[model samples]
Target: MLEVQSSLDKFKKTTGYWDFMEIGIAAIMIPFFAYQAYRLPSILSKFGAILIAIWLTCVIYTALKLKKAKPHEGDSYIDYLRQCMEYLERHKILSRKLMLWYVFPCLIGVAMIVVGQLDLLDKSWEQIIDTRMVWITLLIFMAIVVFAHQTNKLVVKKEFTPRLKKVGELIRSMEEDQVES
Candidate 1:
């Protein structure tokens, strides 16, 4: 029981840190994106800013939602374990789908910013496509995406999956013990 409590405490601490960090990042990013959209002259820039703002807002919302998964004081061990499992499962799903939720929107937003900047120079579509800026931006985006994806995978594999399994084992053990009682 002490071991289970320790594990739960660790999980809660880790998750609290993660969720708060995400919220912090999103809070900074939302205003930045909103400012860019409000100040930028180009239509594409505005659109890009909007996209980024929306994405970051969703990020904040998700983080806040995860933050609400805390175990109440009166909850039993099984209930607390269940809550932790649900939290882990949600994070696992989010980590697995990082490309969808994290990379793709940012990619589109950055692409728009790059293209819009080029567009402001009175460049034709062909000229814009021919410029090194587009390719470089794309390459940088791809590199970042790959690194983030790999990092998320590693965290899920090393941290989340093991914790989830431990929590599951604890829950089952508790259930069996209860049954025996």
Candidate 2:
């Protein structure tokens, strides 16, 4: 019980951490993306604009998702337990959906940035986007998708589910206590 509570307390900290992490990345990337849009020519400008828009939407979506887990104050023990369960369940649902909204843009941006840099070796941008680069980018994107899915599964199984189950048991016990009284 003590250990469960300890884990719960630690898990609670992550509720805020997600918001901070997301915001920090958004802060860093928004300006950079905007700058890319300003400086890049033609199609790359369009790509940069699309990337910025997607990234902004992702940031907003992620922020809202993380907000669902923020605990409110002044709840009684049973209510607090219930709130925790709701928070964890929200996290579980969001984790499953994260790939679609969060992973694709991130993977695309990362792959483009890395592969784009290869053009520094006197290769033309058009040449850089050749079949080999396409294959490599495709592979990287696939890897990121798998990694994100597995990570989400592992965190939910290891953290959110356990905390949710523990809080639920407490809620049930408290409800029974109230009923007995």
Query: Model 1: per-residue lDDT, tens digit, 98-170?
Result: 8998889988998888778778458777886788877888789979988998899899899888888888998
Candidate 2 residue 18 Cα shift, in angstroms, is 2.7
Query: On residues 112-132, what C-alpha lDDT tens digit does candidate 2 reach at each position?
Result: 554444443457767766648
Clashing pairs in 2: none
What does each candidate score in C-alpha RMSD? 2.1, 4.3
Task: Using TM-score, give the best candidate's number.
Answer: 1
TM-score of each: 0.89, 0.78
Give the poorly placed runs of model 1, Cα more than 4 Å off: 120-126
